[model samples]
Target: MKKITLVFLLIILATTSAQALSWAYPFVVWSGNVYEVTTEEVKNSVISKRIGEVKTKPNDTTGNYYGNASNEYPKGTQYFAISDISTDTAIAVRVKKEKYVKAVFVHKASSHWNPYYYFILFVVAVVLFSLLGKKRFH
Candidate 1:
């Protein structure tokens, strides 16, 4: 029983490590709208008018923000207009919580493209091929 418990614990640890290594898309929901977050270099002149200030709540998770579904922004995040363009579709922003001044782009959500579906399909295909190949040979 002790050996069985040790094996179970090891399996759990392995699975948790694997999950930690997986990457997720960056997203944030604000003002009843969802935006995908990305970064790019923009001239200080292009980062125009002050739009809004980031009011990140205590419950907001800023560290692992990739899969965060909350509407709260990260602490110290401030948004600015992109030249003359500032709309629901696109905007220029800055995240000040990091070590350096980080410029970010907030774009409207496109579609739900969960990559895990493809991984699951590949695993199924491999299993089916192996099973069918073995049967044909026997």
Candidate 2:
């Protein structure tokens, strides 16, 4: 039973961590402001420039963009942003540590997760086992 429960938890964490982040490779997006950060930390980001709307030819596909960064990135640039950033449109940033292109689903809002849901499920499991009784009924 303990092994089953442990496995279940590992599976949940694995899936959530995997699905939550599309790419964990170290990358940087500076509002172009100077800042210091580690792979997990971001700071001192500045808005370099917001993409302005322009006339597009037919079959043009684009979204609201507000920032820019070189895909290859220049030296002395931060690798990842520790500060929160939002834009009307999501822009793809370059990851220096990674080989291919990747994206992060930046939310303009916060997220909510119910902790009680897990507690309730745990209670249900306990109740079911108690009702079933121990083997040999001892």
Candidate 3:
């Protein structure tokens, strides 16, 4: 029974880790601002108007031209699709749109792994092991 419980716990942990790695949010960086597509409604409603084709160099990290070390738009500026005209700055633009850029290279928000969660898990395992060991010895 103890072995079965341990196996089940291991399975749960594996599933959680897999889910954490696979999930990702989609976003677009335009005019030095990041916009995250939260729902299907926003993704469908928001459309980027093509101004003109501009050559862009890929960044070192993401290998994307839009957001590199410079953090500026490409040389040739074309499209200007304003979802919210109220914002004066890029940071404000993110706040206004309710989509903030977590990382420039990825151009998306990544869920951070909290160490406390693992610490709690470890404590629980230790407690469970102590309890089980005591039972087995008695």
Best by lDDT: 1
> How many clashes (backbone N, Cα, C below 3 Å) per candidate?
0, 6, 0
The 0-to-1 C-alpha lDDT of every candidate, in the order given, reads 0.52, 0.35, 0.40
User: Which lDDT tens digits does candidate 1 get at residues 1-138?
Assistant: 999999999998888432232225444544434555566555676666665654433223223222223243564466655776544655555655322232333554334324566799999999999999999999
What is the per-residue lDDT of model 3 for residues 22-105, given as tens digits with 9 covering 90 to 100?
224433444444443333232313433332322343343443434311233344433323344322221211212333222222
User: lDDT per residue, candidate 2, 33-112, as tens digits?
Assistant: 21211233222243233232211111112211223322234433322322244432233232343321222433332222
Residue 130 displacement in candidate 3 (angstroms): 0.7
Q: Which stretches of candidate 1 lie over 4 Å from their true place?
A: 1-23, 57-73, 96-138
lDDT pick, better of 1 and 2 = 1
Scored against the true structure, residue 109 in model 2 reaches a CA lDDT of 22
lDDT of 3 at 35: 43
Question: What's the TM for model 3?
Answer: 0.26
What clash pairs does model 1 have? none
Q: State residue 61's C-alpha deviation in candidate 2, in Å.
A: 39
Steric clash count of candidate 2: 6
Better of 2 and 3 by TM-score: 3
C-alpha lDDT (0 to 100) for residue 34 of candidate 1: 50
